[model samples]
Target: MKSCQCYLFRPPSIMSISSWVCLLPLIFYTCLAVGAKPASPQNVNVLSLNTNYTLTWDWDYNSSDALPVSFTTEYIPRFKLSSKRVVVWNMACEESPRRSCDLTPLDLHYLSIFILRVRANVNGSHSDWVQKKFCPDTDAAVGPPSKVDLGPAGGHLDVFISDPLTSANISMREELQELYYHILYWEKSEDTQDLRSRSLNSSVNMVTLPNLKSWTWYCVSIQTRYDFYNKFSSFTNPICMQTQGTLPWWQIVLYFLASLLVFFVLMLLILCGSFWCYRIVKLTLYPPIHLPKHFQEYLQDSPSSDVPRLLTPDSESELLCEVTVCPEPLVLEVHQPPPEDLEEPHPDLEPDIRHSRQDSGGSNDSGIYSTGGSSGLRPCPSLSHEGGRTSCQDIYDPQQVKMKDMTPGIRSQLIIDEGVLDMSV
Candidate 1:
């Protein structure tokens, strides 16, 4: 009756306490092993410059776990978080040992919103993922201008700015769409503290600085700025240039006038030299003729002198005569023509004959005589023939002889005999 009456539930026993105590540690160990995991990544961030993107995070590992730990980076568009369907994250880095991963390969849109996450893994156990929100156009830092150039205008300076570029050589302006420039300029001789600033619109690439001193050196630096994100970049290196100076109008005019004056002076000198050269050449080519002094005097003295008188004899001529004498005295016989055979001389010829005898001086002893007449003449008969001599009379007139028409020997003989005659017996 006592066994039948035993209940299905057993009463408390003394050894049950130790068994329960031993089983409690085993249950707690099983529960602890199931719940243990690696620490999650912390401080997850995205670094962006222009088109370049990087994902970074921090993780603290337990020293007691001697095994190495690795990290994984993933990304998902922020718009996908609100979708009714299941959303999956794209892997940026898988089991990477580094704390940072390059996200540029993903080619994320600059205008789209993205969620970036990182996690830590060790010994086949993974930690929870930490996330950060990023937008490249808004969160990325702008960079300085790629290039800066300066040009000199008249009393002015021209600044040319180029947009910043990414590591891949992509322009920041293409991504930003609203890029601005901040310009700082100062004179090289002035202190940097006295720099002047200028802000340019997004579309403007060139700017002119007016009211600058001429021939003065100026330095300029430019930076990129994004107003939507309030992001400003570091300024570029200073570029030095000089402003051009302009000449005064009066100086230009003076130079022109001086050049014109020089040209005119040169032309005048050339003309004078040419004229002098022409005169010298003309004189050398044709010379003037002049008459002799004696000829000129002779022509002036006698305008109508006869040719014969002009040919007067020289004053240095000398007349010569010779006389001959016979060696022996001999008797001469003369043949006398009869008086009836000879024609009688005319009465008018008697004076001429007497004058001729005086002119001849009875020099002829051969019974031959000449009469100075154009017609025929008769010889006189011998008057006596004795002592080897004959007397002869000749008619001669000096006025009737034409000396010009006679031979030179006869004229000379007549001239000699007229002055003096010599006879020998």
Candidate 2:
């Protein structure tokens, strides 16, 4: 047997360094002429699809490197790299600059979490696998399409074809690559539990159902699927909704009447509001009234007058003129009774009085002393004045007391004027 020795040595001399420098430009040109690829491979960027049962891969190529035309995707149920492992297909990568591919983990062993990797097939020769640790996975899928909304919405499945949902939609994203979807329906609720209904597997999101009862609520359940377990998952929350029913003529009429009534009510409110607004605008633009010139002058000049004279007892004459109103006086007559009644003549003009005298005065010798009102005594005879003013003295009348000769107004004023004081200054 012959033994071979390997030598560990440093560069011998400056001669080698000089020779290498001289050959650098020629090497560079030759590489350029031949379109030579760089020696370093681009590092693979592995991404765990957020749903985490799946993975996608991409790479940033070294500017000097040649890109591989193909890729291979693979996964392992366990963390270890061992003889027992899953190998997905090797295929051409997307032709785009940064090559990418999605790999679904093959987990027949029913792994809760798996390890995934992507490899570039450089010239039909695979590179080292780039791996993501702990890719999450579940045996679950999106629930079934909701039972058709049979209420106000049109239950026609074809309606979705015409009007696509812009806001609420069924979207497939790379992050959710671990899951897929299915739709199913059955006459019996139990049939859906087994995922055995042939009515399922629709590509469209909205489903149009058949045999739904009119004006009745139905119990419908949606089930999610888990791919690795190959089983239908827990049923989704049951949805209950009432379906549309045939409209009776009376109902249709009632609906139209109700709609018309609502429209009329709204119109009436709007009309009233408009009129109110018009009145308001008119008030603002052209006020309801304009004060007289003098009144306006007074208002503009004095804010002090707003405090009324009636509020202050010590107000001046001008305030008194503005705030006070004088009430007219009422008068009653004052009469003096005649001496003893001899049957009075002109009885209508005379007052009749019945009197009793003290016994100290004899019967005819008794002088008459009048008591009570003037109406209790006899009238005095009329006296003719030198000025030709006839004065009627009805001494016995309670209703009228003769005032030497005063007019009703003056007499009333004389009685009432005694009690009051004019404080207005």
What is the Å distance of residue 57 in model 1 from its true position?
1.4
What is the number of residue pairs that collide in model 2?
A: 14
Q: Candidate 1: lDDT of 116?
A: 87
Candidate 2's C-alpha lDDT?
0.44
Model 2 misplaced regions, further than 4 Å: 1-199, 226-229, 289-425
lDDT of each: 0.70, 0.44
Best by lDDT: 1
Question: Residue 4: error of model 2 in Å?
Answer: 63
Candidate 1: give the clashing pairs. Answer: 332-388
Listed in order, each prediction's TM-score against the native is 0.49, 0.30
| Residue range 279-352, candidate 2, lDDT tens digits | 99998999878678577555553544554223345545535665677543333233332333433433543234
